[model samples]
Target: MVPQLRKLTLMRKIKVDIFRKICTNWPNLTCLHVDFRQEMNYSLMKHIFEKCPRIEKLKLWTTMLIDQRCMELLSSLEHLSTLEVLLDKPHLTPVRLRLLTDACPRLKEIHIDWNYFAPQDFEYFLKANKHTLTSATLLWTVGEAQKTSVVPLLKQCSTSLRKLRLVYFDTPRAMETVAFEALGELHSLHELSMQYLSTYEPKLISRAFRPGCLTQLRRLLMQYTTDLLDETVIAISQGCPNLRELRICASYKITDVALSEIHCLRHLEILELSRCSGLSGTAMAYISQLPTLHTLILQFTEDLAKLQPSLRLIVELKELRCLDILKSGNIKAVPFGEFPNRLLKLRELRVTYESENDFTELQRKMPNLKISNTAWLTEDDFPKDDDADYGYRDG
Candidate 1:
């Protein structure tokens, strides 16, 4: 009988009998997240929506196949704004989207993972939410049909959408240059993360990275775009002058020249580059130019002689607080042990070293610094079963 409770989460498998008994207890709930292994049926959906009439945000994780009746029940929550679906099966059909858009007028932010929507579905979605939607995360597969639809749909919400993450899980294809060029039109965007978007012509991609576009972008992450070049990144620096965080992974064509251009981002605080084998030790010198940079991660070290000086150049970053050299061969080969004493602001260090004696000695010298040997950091993705909340908010 906790009527005052406005948020409820039931991640463990709950029997239908038990769920029904307690579902009505939280009539004031505004946020609800349920992760059930059983297929979420109309009855379960009804029990939640009917009982929690005030719910404005909802996350349904597990196997879900909502029929038209379930959609109607969901739309009953007139206050619903944020929706997250991490289903094991593909259930986001165009008909369901049309139902939600037509019925739930306040629906705005949405995160749909591991689902495939047809090209036409995307157009319908963007057209309906063009004026209200502020954030969207879509982790789906992009096929040939999606090429033409992607650009126009993105343009539809350019003035309102502030955050966009498009992660495609399909064979790498050269997406049209205009598709990327469309992103520059999103003037309100502050964060953009794209993965597995390959291109045959690297030069054409730079057109989207020039100034007067993406001026509000503060964070940018691009992964596995092997064709991304130095010129493209240089234009990104010029375009996103206010960027505070930048991460580029597995893009081997980018070298020190691109890193050098990042100094233009005066507010840059975090920089991470991994699997970029094209960068020599010289890139570290370019990175040192960012006086405001506090956190840095470099994960490629095939040439020890070149990397050693680059490791030394970190001393120039007086505000440096965290340094991660994961999977960059042995840490003992470089002068990493001296960083704690040289950079007084250093507090966390992650490397591939294994010697207990060396770790004890460094800890003894700098008691304030914490060090670890984790091999790789996880890629930021949708929340899982262990993670309690998806951290979404009303728009």
Candidate 2:
């Protein structure tokens, strides 16, 4: 019998039972993820930690309330290398965050989903754990008035951080100077994802790409507003020499000039230009010329005819593996047979059309192709609208 086959609703209950069984029968359990709605009672959490002494990776999703016993148990787990916590509350008070950090001195990576927290509490956590923290993800919901404090905390931790993702909510003005100033100090940073709230300004975004601050950065994701200009794009290409993946979807202002600037990224491999209404044939040709480009995504563009002329050159990109041309209402025609057979390396293809006949014709031309109707796909099938929003554009 499997111990009466209990139905566990909470992650904690499942973890407790599984680990208890593992300790009794197996010698080691290395990884655990707990998704529990309510806070874990400290003693029960400690018991699980004591059982899984060899655990190296731990992921916890819990309510806002701090369980001191759980914290104490976590502190005793000396081998923890990766810790990811998703908190239901808006913020983790500084003291509780510090306690967790202090317990895991050997932690190499930490990801936190902070719902509500004081700006200084984050600063204190950074200051206390600066030496041990190498990568951090902070999802913050901050007000307009509290924006100034966010950057200083980031700047303080930038020296030791290699990857930083700052997601802001309801605080656009904070995206300006303070954030960039802190970001510029991150000498070792390789990846950055910054999503600004409604208060984002063009100047602040431009400043983030200023040369020398992001010398080591290879990947950058910016989610801003339509106010971003061509200068910002130029500045980014010039600043990050090793950039390999560039996703600028939903940027209504991107034009031929901005597209041309992307050529500066010699190492670029993947480029996504979805929902960019200003793209033209010239822009498409320029992108097709990227020597290292393997994957190209152009979804929901307003001008499909502009891209039609460049399709031949695009198919000639020998290294191209995946192409997504979905939701371009302007693409009235597709030269399915015209594509060079030499593009044998192509693997994945996505297109959107209302007519089943059009899809059938496309499938007949490329028998190995995988086609998806964007009209039928749900939001989960594609990146979220807000995640795809590239607000910066050259007006």
Candidate 3:
């Protein structure tokens, strides 16, 4: 058979050297996901370039070797359009970035997760391939350099960029230090995801959604961004009317007002507001009205009473699919009279309570629904003392 391969995803657990053989066999392979713990030899990597010349989509794991020779080999692959690399010992430098992008003119999506120094040549890479890049994910070791590295890249690629994910690990106030105004300038951007494991400034992030900016944005994900407030939610609801999916996990300041503001987003398909304290029933009422919502996650609410009234309105959501209210203390006992009128499509439901009776009733009534392992959580089980483990999913 002619070597007209297109994609190859291989995870190496064995010590045997089968990868080199596979790469040599597939000369026309376009996409390759190599998640191996073993160190890759230069000759084997070089042979990949020589043999699989058409390898375009490349995703490598954290421990894989990518030395200077490997970079030389990478520079030979001309058809690469998407690249995701998790760097370990040998950090990703701009020189190597330039080498790869210079070789691959069609490279459009670049996702780099590094625990090393911010690549000094980041801006140069952005400038050279700005027109071609539409989706980019840049993650660096925890520090202020993240803002420095990201701000300029966004500025350079503002015109053509459509999707972006910026993560600064264990860095508190990374978002506060960056130029949020630069994000607003990217008019073509449709999807955005921001992750700062330690801390992130939501007010500054909200500034990016002012009126004309991000009007076409469909998806917004801010994991562990606890400062997202009503003001920002209102601004997003106003500016990003086309918003489809929103995830605000472990946010502190968000309340009923914020949900009320975003309830009118007619196009919203998925909403996840987990571990948000200080909410009322009024907010849940607003969420019930979202016409297009398919997946809703309101797990671990501070006040269970606030979520109870909204349970009745949830049945009104004809399109609702997955609902997660686990650890919210909303269901001490399953209410037989207050069951959803029509949950024909409801596939997965998670609740935190120890009751075989509850599970049995739910199963008997809705045979299609999959009630997962009961999360027997008491008030004492709530780890308010440990912020790190507070919202940690049981699964």
Candidate 4:
């Protein structure tokens, strides 16, 4: 063992008292990750700061509200570069959040997923310290003043902002209408995702293609926008030509014409249009022409399986390596006989049907392909991050 080659890292699920001992034993620990239930208060945080001064990364998931006291304790950690905090209680006020950011000037990334709805303090925080933040995810509630003023506030981070996520992390049944606009000023953003819970949004995006807004964007995800129409798809294809990945789920109003507008995206690699009702085989007909597309997921889109020609059009996507057609109404009824020639590049396929599904011939086609039904893995494969689960281990 070399004297100067010591590297310290710890990711485990231990009682607080045991964790305190571990911190005491290794004062040079630079990275720490615990389960979501790890309790934190002034006393625990005080001892942590005293013992683990060299820590650079921290993740804590709590079931309590992050009020001023917790903010004060977190503010003392000045060298933190990445922080992720998921709270059970909502409402992180603007003043306290500003205090935390001001206290830690070097923080670059923060991702928080909370229950209920988020307030407008996050918008205020963005306006105040836009330069220090390079990536942030702010999930807010539905407020008239909050929704309209949110996009304009992102302009403050235009200089260094690279990643941004504005989504709804509300309860399962709670839905709120939100209108999206003013993305033209964020030229530096490379990844932008806007997810909502409401399907009745008047218009997903008012005007995203005004020439300069999404010019440098590489990935865009718009989910839960049930009213996403053909015009909006045209706006995305026209506005952000540099996009490599796009996901639009649960879009009810999108038709074949909307997907035809996406034909201009020559550089697109990954695309997912799950549960879009209005689009029949027409969208897949055009999507198969994309030369660079590698992955496609069109789960539960029954309209796409209208005819045999429709299913045949998908096999034309020779570049596609992964395809998910699970729960898609009747694509299986089309008889491809033995399917031994088409889908040469496919490596993975997932599908599910109500009656007997004959995978015998489908397996003969892509002998090397991995196929599975459109269902979640066993509980042991990926454990939940609750009291009993430890989640992912550090790499």
Candidate 2 lDDT at 140 equals 38
Compare candidates 1 and 4 on lDDT and give the better one: 1
Candidate with top TM-score is: 1
- Compose the digit string of candidate 2's lDDT tens values, residues 242-332: 8887777666676777766777788888887777777676776778678788878788776677765765567666777777887776555
Q: Can you tell me which runs of candidate 2 are displaced by over 4 Å?
A: 1-27, 36-39, 87-95, 115-131, 139-148, 169-175, 223-227, 306-312, 330-334, 353-395
lDDT of 4 at 224: 59
TM for every model, in the order presented, reads 0.85, 0.78, 0.82, 0.79
What are the lDDT scores of the predictions, listed in order?
0.71, 0.63, 0.67, 0.63
TM-score of 2: 0.78
Return the candidate ranking by lDDT, descending: 1, 3, 4, 2
Q: 344, model 4: CA deviation in Å? A: 1.9
Model 3 lDDT tens row, 1-395:
44677887666644436767777778879888775465577877776778888877887644453456675677787888888775434444433565765787888887765533334456556777767789877653322344344654567644688888766433335444445676777788888876433435546667778898888898887757766678877888888989998887787777788876776588999898888775666666788789889888777775566666664667767787777787766464224333445656777787776776767866787778777655444542221112242223110
Greater TM-score among 2 and 3 belongs to: 3
| Candidate 3 lDDT for residue 50 | 83
lDDT per residue for candidate 1 within 1-395, as digits (tens), equals 67789887776777887777666787888998776574478887888788878889988753554565765677788898988776544444433566677767888887775455666656676788888888887643433344343544677644588887765533224545556677677788898876555555667767767799888998887766778889989998888998998888788888888877887888899887878888876777788889899988776655545555675777788899988777776556566566666788988888777676778877888889888877444535222322222212100
Clashes of 1: 0
Cα lDDT for residue 261, candidate 3: 70
Please give the RMSD of candidate 1 to the true structure: 4.7
Where is model 3 more than 4 Å wrong at Cα?
Answer: 1-5, 62-66, 88-95, 115-120, 140-149, 169-178, 197-202, 333-337, 340-344, 352-356, 374-395
Candidate 4 structure quality by residue, lDDT tens digits, 1-395: 22222234335445779767666676776666655556666677678767776666776665432545765777778887767665544353433465565677777777654432233555555655667678766553424233333455566434678987765433122223222445666788898876543434444454665455688889887765666778878888878889899888888888888877677788999898888877765566788778789888778877545533555777677787887777887765543452346667878877775543567667766679877776555542221223122111110
